[model samples]
Target: MKPFRRRSLLAAGFSAILSVQHVLAIQLDLQSTDSIKAAAKTLAGDMVSYYTGYRPGDVPGNLPSPYYWWEAGAMFGALVDYWYFTGDDTYNAITTQALLHQVGPDKDFMPPNQTKTEGNDDQAFWAMAALSAAENKFPDPPEDQPQWLALAQAVFNTQAARWDTTSCGGGLKWQIFAFNTGYNYKNTISNGCFFNMASRLAVYTGNQTYADWAVRMWDWCSAIGLRDAQYNFFDGSDDNLNCSQLDHIQWTYNAGTFLVGAANMYNFTGGSQEWADRLNGIIGNLKLFLKNNVVYEQACEPVGTCNVDQRSFKAYLARWMAATAVKAPFTYSLLKPILEASATAAAAVCTGGVNGTSCGLKWTEGTFDGSIGVGEQMSALEVIQSNLIDIVSGPVSQDSGGTSKGDPNAGTSSDIGPSDLNVGEVTTADKAGAAILTVLLIFFVAGGAWWMVT
Candidate 1:
């Protein structure tokens, strides 16, 4: 063979091998969309059962009370999304029931005091997100739905009112009671949730203030929170340095929340090319982090370089990555591999006995051997399933509808009385309180267990 021809053949052979490897790594049976749907359905069902059965109240016994609320809200939101995509009324009914149980007339809305739980701001984000999903699904405005809107608005106001311009360079305070105490610091997760909720509220109310807050929060994150040089996804504090020293100590939820927030902003703003470019950059970095086969080990920082070994970060990353793929513009071919890999990895973690239907994956590390926490499982499944829905339904046209605005009356609801504003102390000694405490403890242990295992 001629030297030039030989070289071309060699290059072609190498490219073929690479393509085969990529296909094998993904391990998706393209012919088995039914299997994928079934797996997602089972996972969603298990998650709803776990949250409703194990963690029923907002009290700190096992997991911190605030954590439970956050997870519950997130799970409900995901379930609502799932219903939206799959047209599964079961998921919808379960999610509505769960939200009513948590935020309905008789439930404790905030976490107990002395638990060191961050304020219910995270729940506010979840509540607002879920409400948005509910509204999107059922166009007819509920007569009593005004109360739900009022509750979310009250939470948003409380969060906005607690914003601190000092120390952290102007971001929402993490914990309301610990304002400026310096013990509880400003972190990306809180701000991400704040931005996400604010953006949603802005759309719902048709108000620009909430939209402005969302943009400002994004600016704060991009400017101060992100450690671009070292590949750190978010800062633990607003005043932190830009160096990537924190890269080794990455948190899955932090990255996921930030990406979702960014995606939400992009969706609301009618597809800014800059936002799309930034998301692509982040997506590239994230995929590079996943070069290693193990999800948990891929992003281990200071202790190990990125993409090293098995770690629990995959659950959170998978959920967020799926969220990004679903909401943002991306080629189906690019997303198909990721969706398959994420779903497969999630399935491997199922502790609920993977007989195709009843088994569920553990969202965090310490979940009961057979349990899948509501938030983790629901978010993960929602991300994958929602993307699948979009893929099947066809790409969303940029001009389909302009970004929805936040509710105008979101901040000034007189119906949110004084009682709704108070975040009482944690007292779990009573029977009802003990039950809440037990559930919280279980979630906490599961989260701690996942953290340790990862």
Candidate 2:
């Protein structure tokens, strides 16, 4: 009877262990790719509706006027890429319509007044790339293709005309607004965007001028961006009073854009160790900024006292980090642990419910409910779903046929079923772990107190 009881106990323990392992291994299919595609489609549909029927100067979702240019440009690029990868004609049609709306008579650009800034030139890059790609894909070009290309060319020409070598070590001014403000500071974000756009433009149009601009811009940024002693980079301009350096001296987006810009330049100009070194430096600083299992901005200090505003920036940081992890060399190994942690955290939060609808981490309490106006869903989506994994895993080199071995959906989770446990239960587990640690510390303190008293 005693032997039988022991055997039963052992069997129960083994079963418990197996159950735990099963939970750990269970990857919830968030339908991430599908979700991203759906979101992109929804956004594109909104753009089409706004452009075709809405009142003049009307915008979607009450977004500020300054953001419209970049937002539309980015959405256009994303939709274009989605269409390219999935061959979804719906996305293609919407992008074409949206681009056509911006094209005008005599093939001159009629950029909505809202998008007039040269700083907003990055949007044109994305827009042009998508439109040019669409024209290439469909041999029967749209009537508006020439108009669109001409518009893009004009915008590029205007921006290139503004590039002055007199100030800030020979780079483009940050923006027209900055120029007006007398804030003619050279910035990493602007220069990086310049490099990215120029490189892509060079590739698409086969213009060595674009390629030259990209290389010159990248070389300028790399030389000025890095801080040798700290092994980090700044956002540009040494004016510490510029609010660009609030707390942490390092930022994920700055690092990410620079790294990506470098990678894109390398793609066009062939590989360079200088670019590789710059990318690695950004990655190194970013890795150092990760603390308490969370990526924080190193540019901000007194980490614990930092305001909740850090949440939004951190989301951007995560997205950039994930992106960098996938794109930069020798960085994937470092990214795996962080990605797994983020995935696990997201899964833990998303567990339970019939359709698993409530599992997402809300940046704030009322953003989704239309209260308090504190939501930015796209940032969350960008961080969670964008192909950062591809950067880390590295893409298979394409042969002459333009085929590569990297599968975007490879190793993705297929299980989308609801979890047996609720989010409350997950919260309880976290609280319980914290409580245990607190009690242990208290006990140690009490023991020390007693010894001193004796």
Q: By TM-score, who's the top model here?
A: 1
Candidate 1, residues 109-201, lDDT tens digits: the string is 333332343354545545554445534533222444334444456567656665665544667545555322322456666677677667655
Per-candidate TM-scores read 0.65, 0.56
Q: Residues 1-454, candidate 2, lDDT per residue (tens digit)? A: 6999999999999787655544432143334655444433432343333232122333221234324444455445444444543345775654554444433222323332322243534444444444334332422224424433344455555445556555445665554433223235555555565665565455445567777887787666545543343445565663333323322245555555555555555555555676666666666666655554444345442333333233234444554455445445455676656644543343333322222222223322211221111112223334444433442223222222222122222112321111311123225675567667645743554344233222
> What would the TM-score be for candidate 1 when compared with the true structure?
0.65
What shift in Å separates residue 91 of candidate 2 from its native position after superposition? 4.4
Best by lDDT: 1
The per-prediction tally of clashing pairs is 32, 13
